[model samples]
Target: MANQSSRYPILCASFNQDNSGFAISTKDGFKIIDSNTGRLCYDRAVGAFIIVEMLYSSSLLAIVGAGEQPSLSPRRLCLFNTTTGAPLREMTFLTSILAVRLNRKRLVVVLQEKTYIYDSNSLSMLDTIDTVPNLKGLCAFSPSLEGCFLALPASTAKGAVLVYNVMELQLHCEIDAHRSPLAAIALSSNGKYIATASEQGTIIRVHLVSEATKSYSFRRGTCPSTIFSLSFAPSLQLPDILVATSSSGSVHIFSLGFETNQRTKMSGSFLGSILPYSVNDALDPAHHHVLHNAVSAGVRSYAVVRKVDKVADSSSSEIASCRSVLGCVLASELYLFIYFCVPFYLPYLYVRLPCPLPPFFYLLTSARS
Candidate 1:
């Protein structure tokens, strides 16, 4: 199944830091789309590309090729300027680049065994960290300078993560999150919190950066599944919620700060009635809500918490309302689905992108703010 889907026309897709826009690379070339208007902002038909990352709403882009053409090698990274339609600078590496992340202050490039950090303004090499063999280039980064931290797997045998202070250029701490190797990791916008999911995908753990010994554990399910992504709500304090997408084609929302037991008891909503309430809820099933069959099971899906609001009710104390956009690629077609909810109501689809997307594609969302 993996090999067959690899032949899809669209190779990669990713949103910018703000989640206001997204870019996709394909066999024909690449294109950038505005999230608000769903308008094609930029299109280039030069060659096939494997990665196309945008810097916020600017004209600057970091792109890498699929190695189909000689000049468009996977080892070469190009800083492209859409305004001038020219390459500002290019960097070549020894091996294929697995992933690239950018913010206003820094640029990060991840290879199989090493990760490089560079000053985004001067393109000067800052530091390199030798990592355990990361074929998937598993890492998490926060773009905010105040909470700017980079997380990398400390060990391949277990879910130990090394958190580095990118701004200070020093090692922060290591967190042993899971018993098994990690499958997905996410960092909050302010860089104060980190979340991890092991290969088992049944339990997700959130850790405070300063206190690695303490963590908030959430049970996803009893049966193991593959977790594709994890995201935290954008906040200066502890995020109120966390979102996760898995191979089960279900999107899971876990309330971090909400009083689920009290809310479940007081509300008459449908979600409240069905939830199993207990005075001593160990797993806290009331706080965990799932949108079943959100996409086709086994299909790759990505979602992000774009914006969250606090609604004060005359009847209730407060309700944490959230809005998010999700994109999923099933077989040869690309589909975008938008979902948001207040309280425990099930998310309803709000928008679907016009069909017949460039064939063979994958979806990505801004993991942080």
Candidate 2:
């Protein structure tokens, strides 16, 4: 019998400080690969356990995971020097880490119901926030780092979303979002929009900070099964692009836009979907039945970043060229019996590009004054 529940490999990956390269956690160990060359720069065995989650802070890399055997001991979170793969610090807790993120100044870790903030330099716990209400999923922090937002399902009702302010540790607002639990949440690079996916595989969008007095919502698309993840484009030219991976090994993308009157609104224009060839199908033609299991169990992850370069302006060819570039990244993997049988696999797909244009530029152009 085929398993109805969808399961994809959850890889742990981090972007380099320059956003030029990426480090991915694999079954054998960890590897640092060149983004352009696709060549392995470094590969070493960390241990026998599969990494659960990872975060990059400056030159530091942190990984969290439990041992091969399932026990009551908490997952071990280890910090390492990315350049040499040297262990820096290791912390253990009874609760497993659900999410991990790093900003310029701090490393934030979200466990089951609590959030831990740590100093980027010392790796010491700076503060712990305990009162977050039923944190369903966490999204990227705002560009200013003033606050982080979370998606919470309505406790009493069916379709509801509760947005929380991480800094203030308060409920900012609530939206009657979807009929099912949220699968993933993503914040726009500009921090002006928020996108969410539900268990039923519906994508919805909302305005982060409003300029008008009204609120708005938009539908991105529906998935064949539950959506496991969501991401937005890093380029400023793109408002927000939504991506969702389904149980049937299909990936979908949506171009998102906003509509506003007195309230803000969201609309998801369907972009397209991709169904890549299964690895087993390419490797072994004799074992076709196994190919279905391989693809169905394979875990897929997606991320986007912007690449900018000066291009000659068509209207003013004599003048210096202006900036023009496009960015994208998408990857998937199947963890069959390959050398190692690590308990949990963490696969991450990351795209790195130059820093985007400042927010003030957009604000100035959109301002009414």
Candidate 3:
């Protein structure tokens, strides 16, 4: 049973084993909501901190975020038992955290300039990789559980991605990617395609470990919006790309497809855009005005909810089931906006929408009416 209150936005959400319930991180803390009861069975405040990124194993949850202070210091990592919101272990580091990923065997953490690998069983540090030039981002193990890859955005003269063999800590392949620092990196579940985006909205798709080399680009228009995040849906049945733009508070979804048995392409019209659904939309003018003003000034964050079954359908259909549903909600001031405020205001706020407005003549008739 899904939560009955469709009006409230979900801060963070993840599925459970039976696929019957979810562990949701909200402004309050963490809560386990029974899908059948639509009631929270467990809830607790892990800390006064906000969740920057979260990963879950079969019954464990790993959350990483900044400390309670405003500084460049590294964030703390906490592991919790999904069934009970109980803290299992906690660890601290030195540099700010960039990403966190938990595989079946190990937990990987990417800091300001280094990568740390840990033993998944004891949450103990197993080894560290600090030789890489500049570690920009981290992609956890694929859905197939083959291995994980590390993305190096920094190159002496060129931009490239360094694929690392997770178990051996050995460099696998270095491919010339882009001319500028990579803004986002993602790998398809099958490990067939690798996509990277830069400051500009230009997306580059490359065939991974293929000798018959081929690549393509998807122009996302002249929206000066930086791609802050990229993720490939973890479902093997429905392989799609999810891109988080710095501009509007929306997550863009694209279906991955292969053309002519060679090049890869991102197709399907604009899936669906998530926006803050104001709660005061139907309230009285005076009261609504106040609520609207408060909401506008408050921090807003959007989360994209993609049902695993939806992705599964794409594998069996020819036309590609492009049906996408969007869920939006407000986030606490600390997590959603504090750290990203400057970037969001300076670059994202001015991004132009993809659609064009009607001509002046078309507007005249509406004005007369």
TM-scores, all candidates, are: 0.82, 0.60, 0.58
Per-prediction tally of clashes: 3, 18, 4
- lDDT score, candidate 1: 0.75
RMSD of 1: 6.0
Using TM-score as the measure, name the better of candidate 1 and candidate 3.
1
Q: Which ten residues in a row have the lowest lDDT in candidate 2?
A: 358-367
Tell me the deviation in Å of residue 124 in model 3. 4.9
What candidate 2 gets wrong by more than 4 Å, as runs, is 1-21, 48-57, 69-74, 124-127, 130-171, 209-224, 257-299, 305-332, 335-369
Superposed model 3: Cα runs more than 4 Å off = 1-42, 50-57, 69-75, 122-126, 131-143, 156-158, 204-206, 209-214, 234-246, 249-251, 258-369
lDDT of each: 0.75, 0.44, 0.44
* Higher-lDDT candidate of 1 and 2: 1
Tens-digit lDDT track for model 1 on 73-190? 9999999999999999999999999889889999999899999999999999999988999988888888899889999898999999999887788899999998899999989877
lDDT of 2 by residue, 1-369 (tens): 123112323255544433345555544456555444444566666433334333322346666653543431236667767676677877777676666666556666767667777766777776676534444434445433554554444433344555555445556776655577566665554445566656666434444542311122333333335555555545354324344445554444443321121012111212112221222112221111110211243355443333433334377754232122233233334221111111101222222232222110010001111
Error of 2 at 246 (Å): 2.8
lDDT of 3 by residue, 1-369 (tens): 013223333445443322244455544456554433344556566433334333432456666543544321237777767566566887877765666666566677877567888877877677776634444443434423464554444454454666555555666676776676565666554455666766564444444543314343444434555554454544445334333333333444444431221111211212112221121111112110000111122233332223323322446655343233222222322212111111110112222122121110000000111
Full-model lDDT, candidate 3: 0.44
